[model samples]
Target: MKVIIAEKPSVAKNIADALKIKSKKDGYFEGEGYFITWAFGHLLQLYDAKDYDSKMARWKMENFPFIPEQFQYKVKSDPRNRDRQDGGAAKQLRTIKSLIKKREVDGIISACDFDREGQIIGDTIIENINAGKRVYRLLLNEWTPNAILQGLNQLKSNEELLPLRNAGVSRQWADWVIGINLTSAATLKFQKGKGQALNIGRVLLPTLKIIYDRDKEIENFKPEKFFKLAALFRTKDGKEYEGFYTEGKEDKFKTKEYLDNISGQLNGAPAIVDDKTTEKKRELPPYLFNLSNLQGYITSKYKGWTSSKVLKTAQSLYEKKYITYPRTASNVLDDSLTGKAAKVLEVMKKGLPFEEEVRFRKSKRVFNSAKVDSHSAIMPTYLVPKSLTRDEAIVYEAVKNRFIMQFMPAAEHEETKIITKLRNADMKGFFVSKGRVQLTEGWKKVENIKSKEALLPSVNVNDEVETVKNKVSSHETKPPKPHTEKTLLKVMETCGRSYNEEDTTAEAMEAVLSGFSIGTPATRAETIKKLTDTGYISALGKNLQCTDLGRRLVETFPVKELFDLEFTGRLEKSLADIEKQKFDKERFLQLIYQFTKEAVQQIKTGEDVIIHEIASSKRSTEVLGKCPVCGNGVIEGFKGFGCSNWKNGCKFVVWKNDKFLATLRKKPTKTMVKQLLTKGSANVKGLTSKKGNKFNAILKYEKNPENDYFSWKMEFDKKF
Candidate 1:
């Protein structure tokens, strides 16, 4: 008998159904010489700080930087609820262990998801069970029977997968080390007597720093005024054309007088066409959708669509066989897919107009063995899903069409540039105008190119056109845009390329790796979403904005490198090296140790004060006003504007983002909450309504006698 372990119960059932092993047992399927069981995602977790030592439980300063001599692992069951563990992961592990120890069992097959985390789950259980059976891995990507069967045919030795497991272990330890040490250090050192936990991490801190920096930039920006010159001319057919006055840096005029002076010169000075240049240009189809690219594309195009949504939709499409694996970093396919290329294209082009045009052929741009890692880029498989939801259909069309466009020809266009010269009583100068005439729609037929550049009418070099009208336009330089879901993902994806260092150690290391990113493509979106859910950031429409809590944490944190982009990039690159089996795991952990020690030491000595967070605190100095119900000091906190009697069961607290003020772009501040508590209402100005009209209203805090959890509520003076 061979025991196969899968990541999830659903996946295990799918594998059993595919292999015809239908005899169901308590926690596994049996019969046909195989016993298949599954883990509920990850059934084990790394040992917490308290598990290493009892002293670490109270989160005291004396037990700072709790770096374990050797890290430990534990079952994923809650410590407080240890008695009930047998029916859960404990039971499943025992079942698998019994199978592994079976006299007839020859070997164990790891049918976990073919990723770092998945590999760790298999490695963890197998090591704990200590079942000396021959271990082999089932490297499955998609859930299809063909994919699984193909994977089963080519089993890899357990030793071959250790590097990936080592990398995963290193990552888990690094995160735990920093999280436990710094969270305690920062919370104890700054937060002092307050019971609030100041959670920190390797990737989470740096990600918050990005939003903080952007918010600061937006806040400190000073808009500058400038002017540009434009000329309006008439064609022989009486059609009007507007051309920008291009003169390099000299184009923008600081003074309106200078622009008007230039405008006066070229108004009606018998201008003759000095040059007319038209060159044919071609725009190749866009690269295929990887996770980040897909997230960026979908988020930008679809208003309500988020990166998480895109990932889920793509994963669903993959399971349904409408598309290939979605959680990949590569945008190009591997040479291995060449055998089924024709059938895949046939299925993709079934009901599309470009069926005859998408001929399958080996192109370096589309398919290359060198560009891909273990997984191929997201593309269509041989199976086409017929009935898809509206969102599914949108994503399906995007991935499929992106693949289809690769086979079609490039988009062709005729770019034209016309220059006119004027010299008379008014001053002398040349004005240039340009446009593009799309000769061939090509790939644009399937892809939405919006609209091609405008086409300019044919004109000779010496032909004179009348100066119909002209004006000088005044403009102001806009501030840097708040990170949209589209831009933030791109930055996070490529941010590992640069960092501040004299020796330039990590940057040099990152140069060897292909794609250096802050977080893995699979988890970047989740990190951003986590930041938002935790109130570190907020989304207005599609734009990501840093909230007060997020900004404050980034600003208050003492260790700058903890939030440094370069450090993150280098660390990520180091992980990639570990994955590639090029970097030493022991050496990487040593570096993490050194960094953590220094960071904790700095926090101990450094005097940057932590927020006087009143969350679960008995008292606070940053009190705004007297609480109406409890007559205690109403204090400002990370999550809400609350009363100092919060520890004594006072529930008169208004959430920072009380639902009443969330849509109005108003985060409840100390002042706002104070007024609601003391005066029964707080008058707010410039509150943007749902229809986008700005209005003012008085916000009042009210408590209900009916509910226990949701006792505090806010009501506005007006209906809106």
Candidate 2:
């Protein structure tokens, strides 16, 4: 009997169904010559810092940067654990182990998702059980019966996948080392007795830092007034178009002097067409979809959709066999799959509008072996889907249409550039205009898109014309816009570098470089979700907003390396090298270890930002008047000021950290708290109300909680 282990139970079931395995056992399916079982994602994981040495369990400054001599793996322990430690992972492992030990089992097949993490999941179980049986890797990108059978026939030996396994192990260990050490150290030092864990990770910190940086940009932005000049001219055919007046090389000016001088030059002046140039141009179709590009595309087209949602929809399409592997990082297909790609195109274009336009022709833009990586680019599977949801159809059509457009002809266009000039002696004005006319709808025909041309009226070189209109408009330098999931995903994919879908830079494929990105294509969505779930980022509408805590975390953390994109990029580059067998694993481990050690040491000696920020809450006045209830002195505190005898149950307290004040985006001041206790009322300004309107109101103390406790009540009475 041969045993095959898959990533999840659903995948295992799919494999069994494809093989026509009928006999269902307790934890696996049995038939003809196979026994198939599955892992619930990951059945094993690296142990925690304290798990190695119980003394290190309680997080303290001295025990940080805890580098274990040998990282150990065990059954995944979950907080949702039941009678056993690892929820269901322990049971699943035992079932697989028992199967591997059977006398009839001659070999074990690693039929996991075929990624590094997938291989680690299956191998971890086998390694722990000391299974001496021969292990083979069955690489399957899809669960179709034909694909499964083909994978089985071309199974790879374990030795062939050593580089991937080593890379996987290194990533796990590196993440654990940094996450465990830095999180504990920062929490212990900054939070002190506050009990808040500042969760840090290899990828999470940099991700959080990204949102924080944007928030800072918005906060520090200063709006400056600027001016733009435009001249509207009428051509001989009575067509009118606006061209901006340019002064030397400056189009936008800080002062009105340049605008006044330039607009005056063309004021009622005869406009002459100095030059007119037109050229025929052709635009090739975009490259195939990778996970990031696909996510960016979906979110951009459908505003409300996010990267996480796109991945899910794509995964559903993959499972339905309507598309190829969805988690791929490659945008190019292997040259060997040219025939297969042709077949996909033929099947996908059955009822497509421009079916006749799409012919079987291979281009370097679509098929390149060097560009192909672990899996082929996302595309159709030669199975035209009929019953798909709206979202699924959107993504499916995107992938299929992109693939179909690749083999089609280039989009042809007639681009025109016209230069208009005024004044030869008194003053001068040079204006330029551009327009594009679609000569042929090539790939655009298949995409069902028409190019909108900025048509210009017929004009001759040096022909005189009249200025129809002139305007000097005022504008301000605007702050950078907040990050939409589309933009943020691109930023993450490009390692915080500015990247566009059309960018063909060498850094485009630099996914493995540390300075490029922190997480893999398979894990970026989760990292984004984690930022939202942890309150590090707030999804306001379709854009990400950084919260107060998020800002505080970024500003307070002294270990700047954790937040730097270049640092993570370098580390990622090292990991990629590990996969390529170009770098030593020990050196990579040392780099992470040293980084953790320095961070821990810095945190230990560093002053606590949490404690400092809390106690250092900027108060309007240092000390308020005496406590009315206790006749004792009252001073300002982080939350509020209270009678010095509060320890003696005076209860004469004024809370600075009031929920009501927070709702109004206001914080209590020593003077406000003092005046309430001494004079029964105080005048406060700029208080935000429920409807988001700002108003001034008179605040009064009611002394509502009448008991032994001297609790003061606040009320806003007179509003202005």
Candidate 3:
């Protein structure tokens, strides 16, 4: 018998169903000579600084740049209570260990996701258990039954994935070293008050810099005024078109007066066609969706959708076997997948109006092994999903339509450019008219994107036309638009360079091929989410703007290299090289260690500069009420309502997500906090019970006399 482990319970169940292992057991499935188990993402995490040495528990200047001689791992702590181990993760780990040690099991197969992180996740658990059985790795992009069976049949020895494991381990350790040392040092040195932490990471700083720079650019931009001259020309046959006046290659005028004078001269003037050119152009559909491009497309097109949401939805679709792996960087399929892709296209194109056009062909643009890395671009599986949620349907259609477009013909257009010159006027420039007419809506039929036709009248060279109307339009240049999640994701994907949404796939592929990006395709969304959650950036509708704290950190943070895009890109490239065995993991980690040490030193010894201030005046003005225990004023904070005299060791506070309140299906709102502080109890409404029933109750937050910790007590109305 052999044992298999998957990254999550859903995947484990999929594998078991694929293999016909239907006998369910605790924390795993068993049958058909196989025991399949799963982990909740990562069962283990690297040890924190305090774990290595107890003295490192407290943030002290002397403990700066503390690097562990040998890194260690432990079961991840519970998110709610850091001091306690995650019960689920611990129980699952035990289950895996017991199965691995079973005398009947001769081999172990890692069925985790095919990525660096996945490799390490399974590897760490196996290593932690000291499993001596022969190990194999099952690599599959999609969780479909056929794919799972085939992947298991063609498993590679676990040793073959050592390089990927090395890269993953190096990345984890480097992030820990940088994040722990720098965040602690910077927060200690610069932050003036409690609660706020200066979060510094290998990827976070550079990503934050991208938004900060864009925000500053908008703030400093000065709009300029400009004017343009346009004419409405009428052909002899009464065909009409508009043309903008151009002097050489310049169309915009600095002064409206100049364009106004020129507009007066062109009225009623006879114009001769100086040049006319028509060219046929074929626009291929955008390359298949990589994680970054897909996120960019969805976030830019849909309102209220963020990159993080797109990633989650895409991942959900992937796990459901509706699409291939969604966390890939490559935008093209591997040549080996031609047969599979053709079969998929044949199935997906059925019943569609343009099914005839969606013929499969092994084109270099769609299938190029050289362009693919680790995994192919995201494409739907041959198994068409019968149902999906609204968000899932949106992402699924995007991937499905993009795949169908690859097999369809390129969209064709006839681009026409006409240059007309005044035959008798004194103007030195010609009026240029450009238009496009779609010759074929080939791949565009999948998305039902209508091509707007700008038809130009039939005209030959030197054909005469009359300038019937002319106008000089005045305009003021607008400041750059704030960075949206779409644009921000693109900037991160390209290591700080901005690209148009239509061209993001090509540019992002180029950046990925060159081994330069702020974060991996799998982590970019998380980085953006973190920035917002940690208050470094905020969303103004769809636009992302750096917060005041973010701007100050950019301007005042001493370690400029952390904010340098090129530096971060280089480090990212090094990790990629390590995965390919072109760079040594130890050497890469050593460099990170050296950098961390220097950065910590820079923070500790550099000139004292405070970046975040507590805003005492504002806090005083917005005081909720007096603290019950300390008799000091209470104010609302980012996470809770706390006593303003916290510096004096007053522990009287109410967390926003207080556990007792959470059980009642409510979070303490400012209104509730105010009522509680003033009246010693708040009249709460619609609190839910464990049985899914809701009732109104009076709630009070009182200190436990024995423990000196706050707890909530409920009082019912007399009628109840």
Best by TM-score: 3
**Rank by TM-score, descending?**
3, 1, 2
Which 10 successive residues of model 1 have the least lDDT summed?
496-505
- What TM value does model 3 have? 0.87
lDDT of 3 by residue, 311-376 (tens): 999989888888999998888899999999989988999999877887888888889998887788
lDDT of 2 by residue, 27-118 (tens): 89998789999888888888877779998967666776799999898788764332236647778888998998999999999987777798
Give me the displacement of residue 709 in model 1, in angstroms: 19
Worst 10 residues of 2 by lDDT: 611-620
User: Residue 550 in candidate 1 has what lDDT?
Assistant: 75
lDDT of each: 0.76, 0.78, 0.88
Which window of ten consecutive residues has the lowest lDDT sum in model 3?
Answer: 613-622
